[model samples]
Target chain A: MLFVPGNNPGMLLNADVYGADALILDLEDAVAPAEKDAARVLVRNALSACGYQGCEIIVRINPLGSGYTGEDISAIVPLRPDMLMPTKVSDAGAIREVSRMMAEAERESGLAEGTVGLLPLIETAAGVERAYEIAAADPRVKAIFLGAEDLSSDLQAIRSKPGGEIAYARGRMVMAARAAGVDVYDTPFTDVNDEEGLRQDAELARALGFTGKAVISPRHVEAVNQAFTPGEGEIRYAREVMDAIEEGKRLGRGAVSLRGKMIDKPIVDRALRVLETARALGLGGAEHE
Target chain B: MSKLVEGIAEAVRRSGLKDGMTVSFHHHLRNGDYVLNMVLEEAARQGIRGLTVQASSLFDAHLPLIDHMKSGVVTGLETDYMSGGIGREISRGVLGQPVIFRSHGGRPEAIESGRVHIDVAFIAAPAADPLGNANGVAGPAACGSLGYAMSDAKCADTVVLVTDHIEEYPLIPASIGEEDVDIVARVDSIGDPGGIVSGTTRITRDPVGLAIARYAAQVIEASGLCREGFSFQTGAGGASLAVTQYLKPIMKRLGVTGSFGLGGITGYMVDMLEEGYFRSLLDVQCFDLRAVQSIRDNPRHFEVSATRYAGPHAKSAAVDSLDVVVLGATEIDTDFNVNVHTDSNGYIIGGSGGHSDTAAGAKLAMIVAPLYRARLPIVVDRVLTRSTPGKTVDVLVTQRGIAVNPLRGDLEEKLRAFGLPVVDIHELKERAERVTGKPETVRPGGRVVARVEYRDGSIIDEIRSTEE
Candidate 1:
């Protein structure tokens, strides 16, 4: 839900729309190679001047060793982005290097150290294999994103319906991030014109335990958000299940029955997770309000 | 005897045009028109203060009118539509008198009924003869139909045909006959016909415009209006032209040939006619040169007057026979009341030329606009100026969704059956607000600036001057 084409001031000014969780003032992949410097300068000035209307601001500096990464970091670190997403990370060493550079730039610019967080992009086959190490590389690393298009190309596999080609990489990334105690986001569905395709892709990501899917278009934001968040009926049922268990516990009963089924600990835990996920998206907490 | 005159100044003098008289002009030349500016300048040179200029429509090209307005040469204004510089000054209350707004149909009805008296009507003819026989289809400034000026010619005390090209004493197939004219003034150029139609009149490539057009076509198909001998009209705009594009495929699929295409005809409508999607084009105004060529060369393209197009007083008009018409709006309220007269901040930018008239006449009056324009939700709590009443407007189609008026429950269900995003008008308003946020209500200061008149000649809404 973070998107930017760094060279476009107009696109950069296209803030406060689509209700993105975070906006990545993208300098990599989205920008032309010749305009990298222009993109960096534009992103730096935009960060200094623009507002994203309460969305967390981030930047995807060009990949380390792409040669644009240092200039991108040097130009942007002083602007103090909320987070930085590095494109095409193949290993932990790259993440550590970016974190070090961010630290040095932060100190030089007189900003509080470690103010910016980092999210390494897991694109290539090596990147997926080293997801755990990359996630655990630096304290600033809070989440990692999969680059499905690149991963499928690297695997020499044809991407199919419901994302069969990237399933293994998705599972590995999720498990690696979980083990390393960092959040994981799925890759964006490239076919923006196909809303159904986007919805199915987002549903698959949600079922596989990703928090949210990366979106390439503003139109995709709503579908991705809906797929990630629990529906109203699900939220209500989760609340009802929790209330029954709470009442049973308060009455000193060992069992709780709902709709003629005896609910046990695992079921209760699942309901709790559902409610927690909804509440995390700022949905079910309003019941108390 | 030949009715030729010396210049605009001589025509004004020979017509005995006085200081306080109401001089009229037609906007058939559209943005390319030079007659309005030239005549006003001559009238100003004549020291004719307190003169009222009754034009069919005003464009940015008439910005020079602002100078005359300031110099006290022109003290009053009346028109079916106004835009650009003149509209800005009028909205700012530069003129002491309140402007009078009439629908395209209403203006002719007024002129015919003696409600609006024209002292001297200036006709910008592309081609004219010494005897004052003129037509829009003949010269370099050819604009196809002089439908708007026909009423002024028939009713004005004195009519002058101003042209750059004067032919032999006889001008064949005259749109305005010589008997109605008192004088003919030849000029260097009537206007640049190329500027008459811009690239905007073509189908839009914007995804939003395409989506709305698709939904609009679906609405037409769902309403069962895309059948054999269906009569239709659409504005010359991105979404409107795109609707024509989408409808062509639908019409082809259904094998239904529409009866006629009406309103300001564009090249797309001409294409529809030639492709057998439609039978004929009843062009009251032509939006492009292709339409001009079609009107002149093709027997199927017939030029009709504004009264014959949508006049409520007419026993039978073309709009009355219309099965559907696609329009655009600046604002639409939950009640389905429309405002095309002002912007988000309530500054005047447009006036209803045929909006109310067609809405009143057509069986299915569909309004297509983006849900929000530049973050200003077009669906408002209430329109700033109620240009077209809610009851007359049948359906509202936005890029995001479609809403039918409560009066049309059948259309609501029909749209839903088409698998279109059919929502309540209020829900559509809320959806737009969810994206654009609710804009602050724009209630301009208390001074009334213009009166929005319905086709039946009743004041529907009063546009107040914006002091802020």
Candidate 2:
């Protein structure tokens, strides 16, 4: 995903050409306080006027108490964006309020109820603790995102490049979202110039079981996508494992062995998931072969 | 037999520059050149009138020529390229005769064929001996590869060498020797070193530019010509130069060794030559300080004259051997005709320095540009000026998609087989129109302001004066 400034028409017009799976039209932090109302209208009209190629458009509305969320939600909900990411979200009540507002707007606009999904941003320390409740607050909550910059300031910790300060929060948020059966996203690596550092950070997030990572720069999109995709060797081995399973089933055998190693249920499931993700990304798959 | 004159005034007097004669100058010094202004000032002081200025290229530093045109000192203009400073005045019908615009190759061809007679040629040498032997690789205003001036030295009736640095008896390895020079004049300074060569030529950081470059590189790779002994040329524009940068890794991965890198050389091309990605560099001009240094120190970085570079009348030129060339455009019509001479507003901003020559010579000629700039589509229904005809152009690569010329069906099939986004040229124009609504065509009115001459000595297009 890429975060495009909501107020910049140039960036907004070109947001989808960068090959990002999702575009976050940011109106919370990128737009100034003085231009909040104007940026909301600009983003709403942009959604109506322009085609984001095929990217899933997510509008990042202001927090619940910012005095602008009500208008942002009302103006953009009628556009039927793919999702709405509410910033600085703390507890289940915040999620419920935004969900209720979305439902009301959907009904008034003649869209089916829960037409737009909700992505709760867990930034504060209290939000990290109650992440599960927020993720499970309503059926509209599709995913929970980690905003480490605000969470570090809330904890009064020094931010480092290796991101030791956010380790606990990352683990806790991932576990919470997993327990609630919702997808989780990691924070954006802020350094636009450091591709090596971004690679390492994205690898760490993937290892920690985050479904995807957001990027603040378009240059980082390719590197992040590369780090998250399964490699050629992995894809080849997954195809072999599936072939072995098929052969075993034809022979009526109880177990399948590939290269002197037994392919168990968990291994089969992991292989299937890898092939599924690779197929979704339009890579070389068994179907193509 | 010293051949050394006191100053430009003496040189102008000794050359017998008549009132209606044509004098020429090279653009090695680019925007920092003072020799053009100084010589024209002396000619004006000498009460010369109706003189035609034949320069290889003009820059913003040559804005004084506009004043000379107004004062009747200069009545005619001929150049391969003109920057916006002087071009704006020309577009407003300042000169009595229309400016004759030619490709870098066509300029030398016209000079050699005697179709465009030169009465005098002023060569700006950074370092020269009293015997009129000079080189561009020394002194304070050291601009490497004095390639454009070599033609003027050989064919002009009178050749005057102007230099700020006077060397000892014999300047070894002189780019322009004493045999061709008539008078050697000493000046305080030829040009500012800062503007002669750029300090650094950095790759583009714009994502849109990079995306276009990436697609162009892919097109080159898919052309099936990127094998052993690949020869390439690209301009100094950010996106054009970035294509060279992107091709570096592809060449490495494929173990492809290019025969030569051509055109106005940049530091990135120097690096590629030094790294063995290319066996050598054929430079007609140095665009940066690194290129100047490399041309001075490395034997592999050889300099060639403008005629040898791309002159259509020459027996053969380096452009004939080129596999690919990447160019930029202000506007490209659906037919692939490119207009680099005028902007969308019908204002003269650039010209075809090597655009037409290389497009005619290269096997695959690709144009890299964004689909739209500032809400104006780059692919228009028709261009304001046709600097390069559509038949020679092969591909148009934009961030949205790549459009191959319908004439090259084989290339279109190759790009499609590689899974590259190959769209019809008309569809590409439509894609741009969908984003930016159809723009009103700009039809410049009034008398003709410039005549765009192709490399083959035919008038391809005529640019009319812009109405205020």
Candidate 3:
């Protein structure tokens, strides 16, 4: 995902060309208080005008207490974004409040209930403690996002390049989202110029079992995607695992072994997921084998 | 006994430059050039009128020519390319006669064929001897190759060598020989060294540009032309130059050594030559100081004249041997005819420099540009000006998708088989339109302002005045 300032028409129009899986058009922190109304109108118009083909469009609205959230919800729900990322979400109550406003907007706009999903940003200490509840707040809650900057501030902790400060929050959010059967996204690396650092950070996020990572700059999108994508060696091994399982089934054997390693149910599921991702990304695989 | 003249005015007086005569100059100094303004200002002071100026290219530094045109000191214009400073005036129909725009190859061909005559050609020699032997090296404004001036020197009835640095009696390995120079003059400064060559050339960091570059490199690799002895050319635009960076790793993995790199030489091309990615570089102009240093020190980095570079009538040119070339377009129609001359709003901004020459000669001509720039679709229903005809252009690479010319169905099959994204040209246009809503077409209904001449000296299209 890439974050494009909602007020910038130039970046908003060209956001999909950067090859990001999703675009977060930000009307929260990116827009100044003076430009909130203007950005809201611009983003609402852009969502209606641009198809944003093949990419998920998520509008990051202001927090529920910001006074502008109600208007943001009312204006954007008509355009039917894939999701609305409510910022500064602390607990299940905040997610419910935003969902309530969204339901009202849906009724007014004649859109079916739950047409627009919610991705609550868990950026506070309370949010981290109640992440599971927030993820399972309502059926409208699809995923939870880690906003490390605000979470660190809430903890009164100093952020560092190594990101030891947010390690606990990161782990807790992933486990929480998994328990609730929803996807969790890692926070963006704030340093745009440090490609090596960004790659390492993204790899760390993937290792922590996060589904995807958000990028603040367009240039980081490719690096983050590459970090999340399974390599060719992994794809080849996955293909072999599936092949061994099929061969074992054809022979009526109760167990399957590939190159001296037993292929179990969990291993087979991981392999299937790898092959599915590789196929979706159009990567080369050992299909012939 | 010395052939050195006093100053520019003396050289102009000695060249017998009178009313209605054509004077020529080269643009090796680029935007830093002071010689064009110096010579034209002296001529204007001498009451010269109705003179036609034939130049290799005009930059913003020559904005003084607008005043000359207004005063009737200079009335006609012919050039390979015109930067927007003067191009804007021409677009407003500032001159009585329409400007004649020629390709870099076509300009020399026209001069050689006597189709366009020159009365006096003022050569901006960075270093010259009293006897008028000149070279671009060993001077304050060392702008590597003096290729464009060679044609004018040989064909002009009178040739004047203007220089800031005067060497010994005989300059060894002179780019402009003594026999071709009629008069030599000394100046305080010919051009700013800082402006003569860029400090360094870097690949674009723009994601869109990088994506297009990646796709173009993949196309070149899949074209089966990346084998031994491949030769190629690319423009100096950010996206076009980035193609070289992508091709570097591909060639390394494939163990392919290209024959030569052609056109304006940059530091990247120098690095490629140093690294053995290419055997040599055919330099017409140096785009940066690193290229200037390389051409001066490296024996394999050779300089070629404009006629030898891309002249259509030449027995053989470097462009003819090119395997692939990456170019840029302002807009391209479904038919693939490209427009680099005018912006989408019908304003004169750029002209064809080597766009047509390399496209006609290369095996695979690829255009690298974004699908839409600044809310305007680049793939349009029709190009505002046909700079390079679609028949010669083979591919268009954009961030959205790659479109191969329908004429090259075999190429489409190869690209698709390689798992590259290939879309029809019309579909590409529609894809662009979906993002940027259909723009109101800009039609210039005013009188003709400039005529675009192809490499063969045929009029391909005419740019009209934007003013009503």
Q: Highest TM-score: give the candidate number.
A: 2
Predicted candidate 1 versus true structure: per-residue lDDT over B132-192, tens digit per residue: 8888888889999889999999999989889999989788889999889889997888787
User: Which CAPRI category fits model 2?
Assistant: medium
Order by DockQ, highest first: 2, 3, 1
Q: Please give the ranking of all candidate structures by TM-score, highest first, separated by commas.
A: 2, 3, 1
Candidates sorted by lDDT, best first: 2, 3, 1
Show where candidate 2 strays beyond 4 Å.
A236-263, A285-289
Task: Residues B1-468, candidate 2: write the lDDT tens digits.
Answer: 668988899999999999999999999999989999999999999999999999999999999999999999999999999998788889999998899999999999999999999999999999999988999999999999999999899999999999999999799879998999999999999999988999988889888888889889999999988999999999998689999878988999899999999999999999999999999999999999999999999999999999999999999999999999999999998899999999877879989999999999999999999999998999988888999999999999998899998989999999999889999888988888877888888788979999999999999999999854
lDDT of 3 by residue, A1-289 (tens): 8999999988887788777999999999999999999999989878887778889989999987789999999999999999999998888888888899999999999999999999999899999999999999999988899999999999999988789999999999999999999999999999999999999999999999999999999989989999999988899889989889889999999988988988899999998888888888888553747
Of 1 and 2, the candidate ahead on lDDT is 2
* Top candidate (DockQ): 2
Classified by CAPRI criteria, candidate 3 counts as: medium
**Which residue pairs in model 1 clash with each other?**
none
State the displacement of the C-alpha of residue B455, model 1, in Å, after optimal TM-score superposition: 0.8
Candidate 1 per-residue C-alpha lDDT over A1-289 given as tens digits, one digit per residue, 9 for 90 to 100: 6576888765565543445788878899888899988888888877776555568887998886788888888888888888899988988889888989999999999988899899888999999999999999999998999998888889999977678888889999999998999899999888868989989889989888887778877667767988988888888878888888878989999988999999988888778888788777778533621
Expressed as tens digits, the lDDT of each residue in A107-200 for candidate 2 is 9899999899999989999999999999999999889999999999999999887999999999999999999999999999998999899999
On TM-score, the stronger of 1 and 2 is 2
lDDT (C-alpha) at residue B451 in model 3: 95
Range of the 10 consecutive residues with the lowest summed lDDT in candidate 3 chain A: A280-289
